[model samples]
Target: MKLNIAFFGSSLVSSYWNGAATYYRGIIRALAERGHTVTFYEPDAFDRQKHRDMEDPSWARVRVYQPTEEAALAQLKEAAKADIVVKASGVGVLDEWLEQAVLEYCGDSTTIFWDVDAPATLARVKENANDPFRELIPEYDMVLTYGGGNPVIDEYTKLGAQYCQPIYNALDPSTHHPVEPDSRFSSALLGFLGNRLPDREARVKEFFFKPAQQLHDKQFLLGGSGWEDVAQTIPNLDYAGHIYTRDHNAFNCSPLAVLNINRDSMAATGFSPPTRVFEAAGAAACLIMDYWQGVEQFLEPDTEVLVARNGDEVTAHLQNLSVERAKSIGQAARARVLAEHTYSHRAEQFEQIMKAERTSRAYV
Candidate 1:
């Protein structure tokens, strides 16, 4: 059955500073391919409008709007007509108002609160008993998260979510595949790409900075925003400011082994896998990720991807890096992602979830 889905998200066209653009593009494109109509509504904020990398994606109708109360209400009214109206997390601003407006206006549509940062959202609600989202949780038809696995599911359920499911981040093989390593990044012993957020800075310090300092003999490349303010005492660590999404393939393939470090909240939450994991895997880059609770569920440790708990472990991986072994691990990870963790797979799972929800609602 064809469905009309209206999504309120961070961005679909601009990866400028938006982390979820790749995810939105991959999933929405797959949904459109499956005969669904998708309308993505993004707020013009954080210079996203100025730095739009993709103006017109054939898969979805991209609507950029101002965040005025009047505009929001009007958008909410229009979005209410869809079969599914998704209110995604981290819209950059006015999250509370948007959540309330979506729930209030999405008349007969299946309202879904899709939390891309489930751990942070849950942590906020846990800290404040009177948080509006706490009351809004039960009202939504379903709650979907990009990560947070069973722990997130249980917490949402306890907080009176009618239904909760994790739609984990997946690779888009077409967009992110093994590419010829760029000479610029290929010389680096290790590389990491992420915006410096407060929640993740300490972990970056622990897992990334300290390790880079210890491995001063080897070159380390860091890319993303906010590092300009960071003190670059480590002589070997190169800061490539603000990398574009288009460069992800080169960024992944260039490094001998890419690093994956979770935000502190996500690390504590255990099952959350960042998008970088899949992106690196898709590029067939050897990955050495900081250990988390459900690392085994997504990729096998020590074989498909190497796991590290501390600076010592990360240093050991760097110290023991062999070209043949790294290639083997990268290839295995690529194969695993292609088979089980692609956007096509995620789109199918989303279809199944929607079908099951519809069936359950019919019975009710």
Candidate 2:
């Protein structure tokens, strides 16, 4: 069906501090390409309005609202009028109220709780027995996650969710393909682009920092917010502060090899590849990622992507990665995502699920 999709998410135009920006862009663009009309509703918060990556896109109508309960609720009323109303996790204001209130406002619309960070969201609700979102899971028409495979699905089902599925992060070749390597982002050996987070700090210390420390002779690059001091301490590593989305392709392509490190919760849960993985792969960057359970599901380990168990293994991969070897692996990774893991492929899967849900609802 050519549905009207009302998406309530964190900043669509600004990628500043919002990690979900890339995923949201790719998926929404693909959905629009498939004839679905999307009206993206984002709030003016965290100075996201001040640092937009792009203007309102042609594919999706972007609606920027004030960050107030009155403003959010007004948008919710409009969203409930659409064919599919999605209240994504982490809208940054009145999140709990939106989770439950979205359901109350729905009539014929298919209400979806789309979680961009399923592992973190799950962890939060699980820790609190009295979390309001826990009891409200079953109230949504369905639940969609930011890739957790069976583990996340089982957890949500246990908490009384009616239907659950993972929408794994995928490549958007059109948006994030290989670009001319920029001198600004050049890294001969390894580069990583992710904002530092508390839960993932210990793991980064193990997977990223220790490896840089071990390979002190090799030049390394780090991009993202909040790692300036850590990067400076490591003599070999240079910090590229807050790389914009526009520079991401160059960031991926310039580095001989780029790394993908999941947040601790995501890594522990597995099956969750962050958007950076696909973005790097889309640019045909040789990717060495920390070992996760479902690595085999997306890319073939060792061949397509080098999976490292620890800093020692990561150091080994970087040391052993010859120009020819990196290029070969990069090509393989690129081909894999393009063939089996593009946003077009994701949009089709999402369409199928919606098809089933709408069909089932008709009979009900």
Candidate 3:
């Protein structure tokens, strides 16, 4: 069946300040390729409209709307006519309002709460007992997350969700495969791509900054937004602010090894792997990631990817890095991602979930 999937998300055309753009594009495009119709509704807030890096995608219809009660209701009404109406987390602003409105307005359509930042959302709900979303969780037909494996599933189920599944970030080999390393970044021993968020600042300091301090002789390149105000006195660490998604391949290929640092909440929850992991691996970049509970389930540690607990471990990897071994690990990770983790794989899973939902509803 050709399903109509309406998505209320951050921004489909802009990755400027939105982290979910890549995930949204990959899955939606795959679904479209499979003959599904997708309509993405993004609020014209956060200056995202001004900094759109991409044109309206051919696979999905992108609609920008004003953030008003009337506008939201209109969008909700239109979306409710579709087979699936998804309200994704971090819609830039008014997330709580959107979540509640979707649950209330989605009439016969299958309502889905797609939590891109599952750890942060769970933490917020836990801290606020009276959070409106707590009661709304069970109302949605299904709860989907970008990452946070079993922990997220268990927590959502405990909170009264009938079904909670993680649509973990996966590699789109077409967009992220290996490219020739750019000379500008190839000399750097370590590369990290992350935006500076308050929740993640301390961990970044501990993992990226401290390690750079320990290994002053090695070059480290940090690429992302919101770091211009940060003082970079560390001699070996270079700040390449605000890397575009198109430049990811060059960034991944340039560094000898790429580092993946999970935010404090994500690390504490233990199953969340951000999009960077798959992107780096897809580009055949050797990945050294911080220790997380479910790291083994995704990539084998010390083989497909390296796990680091602290600055000492990170420094050790940098110092003892063998070119042949790193290359072998990168190749292995690429093979694993291409085989099991890709947008097409995710799209198939989503189709199964929808079919199963329809089957269950038919019996009822």
Candidate 4:
């Protein structure tokens, strides 16, 4: 089932302010490993190219285009030639134009709209009856997502998608694994690494900020862009600006424990676990996620992962957490993800689904 895959995504070489970098890397790399050819078409916007953390990967061809509607449509035309053309959400440049344009090239290629932020997209569609993307949902051959399990799948189906699959975030072990604890990131009792976004700021205030305020004796670390101002507001919290994918292992491992807080829409939508969860677990760091509905699907609570419902519970987990316990839980999470949640496993699932789809289409 070798196919030429053209993936239209954000930045593939950088993780600067893009949270989906790891997710895109894991899936694309694994797909390439399975004998698929991938050409990653990304717009050269948002300074991602300027702050790129890695070279163009050997597994995929990297094509950087100008960040304009004309340039994007040119790339879109190029993408239409591939066996599977994927128009991922949040390309950050002329997104609406690309979304509609890809559908216009529909007959020859297997078109897919891969939504990295399904809950947000669904909410926007539900809020506005006349959103253009909502009307275009069922036009794609298939729909895939970052996470959101059944909740997302059901919504996409209701919107008339012929096929919908939730590819939950999984670890790329080679990229993120246990590294020697570095002093630059050390001495933190708790650490979190995510860009400060509007929908997530309030949750961060409740989970990350308030916990740091309550546990003044403990060291706290915050990483990512746009938190420089907020970082100064907390005395006990250290701000590590823009943690790159290369340093994610140290960011996850140096702390006593790492926290995963879902954005407002994802938290409300329930089954959506962001890439940070798997990245921390891949680094063999003890993970404590803000409680969401599908926690048990990936890892068991209190054993593989600690579920925190509120700031008080997060504080309680930190206070009662022993070094030995942290090690045990970290190891358990690492083992769990490696066995059932690695990118290789995810790639196989994707390949199988595509194979099934192709087979069914052949019958027709």
Best by lDDT: 4
For all candidates in order, the CA lDDT equals 0.91, 0.91, 0.89, 0.92
In candidate 1, where is summed lDDT lowest over 10 consecutive residues?
Answer: 228-237
- lDDT by residue (tens digit), candidate 2, 131-180: 99999998888999979999999999998888999988998898899887
* Residue-pair clashes per candidate: 0, 0, 0, 0
- lDDT, residue 101, candidate 3: 87
Cα deviation at 68, candidate 2, in Å, is 0.6
Q: Write the per-residue lDDT of candidate 1 for residues 69-139, one digit (tens) a residue.
A: 78777888889899999999999878999998898889589999999999999999999999988999999
Q: Which stretches of candidate 2 lie over 4 Å from their true place?
A: none
lDDT of 3 by residue, 255-338 (tens): 899999998888998888788899999999999999989888789998899999987898899888988888988999999999
Q: What would the TM-scores of all predictions be?
A: 0.98, 0.98, 0.97, 0.98
The local lDDT score (0 to 100) that residue 23 gets in candidate 1 is 88
194 Cα displacement, candidate 4 (Å): 1.0
TM-score of 2: 0.98
Give stretches of model 4 more than 4 Å off.
Answer: none
lDDT tens digits by residue: candidate 4, 1-364: 7999998888899988788999999999999988999999999999999999999999999999998888887887788889999989998988888888888964589999999999999999999999999888888899999888898999999999999999889999999999998898889999998898999999899898999999998899999899988999899999989887889999999999999999999999988888999999999999989999988999999999999999899999999999999999999999999999999999999999899989998999
Q: What RMSD does model 1 have?
A: 1.0
RMSD of each: 1.0, 1.0, 1.3, 0.9
Q: What is the lDDT of residue 216 in candidate 3?
A: 82
